[model samples]
Target: MILGKCPYCDDGMIEVREKEVSGKKVKLYACSNAHWTTEDGEMFELRADASCDFRVWQNSLARYGKWLSYKDMKDLLNDESIEVELISKKFGKKTYYNKHISLNPEYGVSVIWD
Candidate 1:
């Protein structure tokens, strides 16, 4: 499925593909020109012609114990001031807090947990 346009490259579109791992199916999202590979390091032919390396894991987009939808991810890519509630674990306890999420080309998605 096409999630949205790529923020890194002018002519790239973000696409999601499914792959089976450990007897389970998982989705991997990446830009059309992304040099992404499967979990086993197997590269996709469609992604071989690379211009951008924007890729993200499906589970990595989760916040507050819930996975974000494609639209939500798109919104996050567009807005820098978007804050998300995140659940943190410390001393066997769960704590919730809000922080702004940012997409770094070198670091992927991240938020200030500290």
Candidate 2:
């Protein structure tokens, strides 16, 4: 699935790819024209060929283990107020708390705990 445009590159689009990490499959959002050789057929392959280096994990948009939708991400990017319930586990106990979520340039998303 195409998520959106790359925030770092002017003409690059963000595309979703499924990859295996540590024996588990996960989704990663990467720039369509990111760091890779023109000879490489796979866009997901990372190479130091001097291209846009913009990629983000799908779970990076998750708040408290809940994945946010594209609309939610767009809303957050627009500075819309959003309250998320964060699930916290400590010492084998589970608890929930509320937090405000926002988009971070370095990170895909961030939650305010304070």
Candidate 3:
């Protein structure tokens, strides 16, 4: 279990648990020793809850005609609400910006997000 640091708590990876409520069971990730909630009883998923961060960040960056550094990309990936492992398996590493050439020749060239 290689866990990334949680941005909100500035702590290490989150803890996962499966709990039963009513007649349904759901998986949730929370801080290692902290429970966060509002007076409204809203729940928050840990920083690692989703894997869309990569796509979100990358797509945003690419749309703005910018290239993200590897470290920045990693940060984006660590803050999603989905399983990054699964996301990685789908998108792989580099994205092919061009239908034929993928930001080759010039890595930082501006490109639109798919």
Candidate 4:
């Protein structure tokens, strides 16, 4: 069974359910009382199907047909479509972009995933 920890209520987490998505095995786990679940954003952070995070990040970077202007970002990630923003937590946008799109640093732009 899937294993995890619950910082909110229960200490030990266990698998509660399983499902298939796009022909991939997906297991859902819980923290005893089933308050929180292991799904898209919580526990299922890895996609064994994908090559790697770097490749995924690079693809996202390349999706921009051409270098997007500052204002273009606002429209591209609108409320109706998607929400995007620049954030600086551990490293600034400039740093992260450098590592992601090293080939085209000038084309790098931060678009928050929401």
Worst 10 residues of 2 by lDDT: 36-45
Candidate 1: stretches off by over 4 Å = 21-23, 35-48, 61-66
Candidate 2: residue pairs that collide: none
TM-score winner between candidates 1 and 2: 1
lDDT of 2 by residue, 25-82 (tens): 6666667876544343334455776467676665664545666665554455345457
Cα lDDT tens digits, model 4, 1-114, are 433333333344433344454465444333344432236543434344432221111123333333333333333323223233333345433322222222112222344332
69, model 2: CA deviation in Å?
Answer: 4.9
Q: Return the lDDT, model 4, position 100.
A: 21
Candidate 4: lDDT of 27? 40
> In candidate 1, how many clashes are counted?
0
lDDT of each: 0.68, 0.64, 0.34, 0.33
**lDDT assessment of candidate 1:** 0.68
Q: Which structure is stronger by TM-score: 2 or 3?
A: 2
RMSD of 3: 13.3
The C-alpha RMSD in Å for every predicted model, in order, reads: 3.4, 4.9, 13.3, 16.7
Model 2, residue 11: what's the lDDT? 85
Better of 1 and 2 by lDDT: 1
Instruction: Mark the regions of model 2 whose C-alpha exceeds 4 Å error after superposition.
Output: 36-46, 61-64, 67-83, 103-107
Ranking by lDDT: 1, 2, 3, 4
Summarize candidate 3's per-residue lDDT along 1-114 as a digit string, tens digits: 223454444544544444443345543333354443333323333244443211112232333234344444344335332112111123556343332112211231223233
Candidates 2 and 4, the one with greater lDDT: 2
TM-score of each: 0.73, 0.64, 0.30, 0.23
> What TM-score does prediction 3 earn?
0.30
Residue 36 of model 4, lDDT score: 28
Model 4: pairs clashing at backbone N, Cα or C within 3 Å: none
